[model samples]
Target: MSVPVAMLMAWFCEMLLLNSRSNQSVFRYSASFR
Candidate 1:
């Protein structure tokens, strides 16, 4: 694969992981308030 393509894929994966992590944290925070 090309260098740029690999870099793009890596960035995309990182963003997805970060989003999921944030979502989990939000859910946990809300659960704690209940």
Candidate 2:
């Protein structure tokens, strides 16, 4: 694969993992306010 593509794949994995945690935080905070 090209270098840029490889870099993007790595970044995507990081974004997915990071967003999963952030999503959970948002979900919990919203639930508490209800």
How much lDDT does each candidate structure score? 0.62, 0.62
TM-score, structure 1 vs. true? 0.59
lDDT of 1 by residue, 1-34 (tens): 6889877766765576577865665555434533
Point out where model 2 deviates above 4 Å. 21-34
Q: Report clashes for each candidate as comma-separated counts.
A: 0, 0
Angstrom error of the Cα, residue 5, model 2: value is 0.1
Find the candidate with the highest TM-score and give its number. 1
In candidate 1, list every pair of residues with a backbone clash.
none
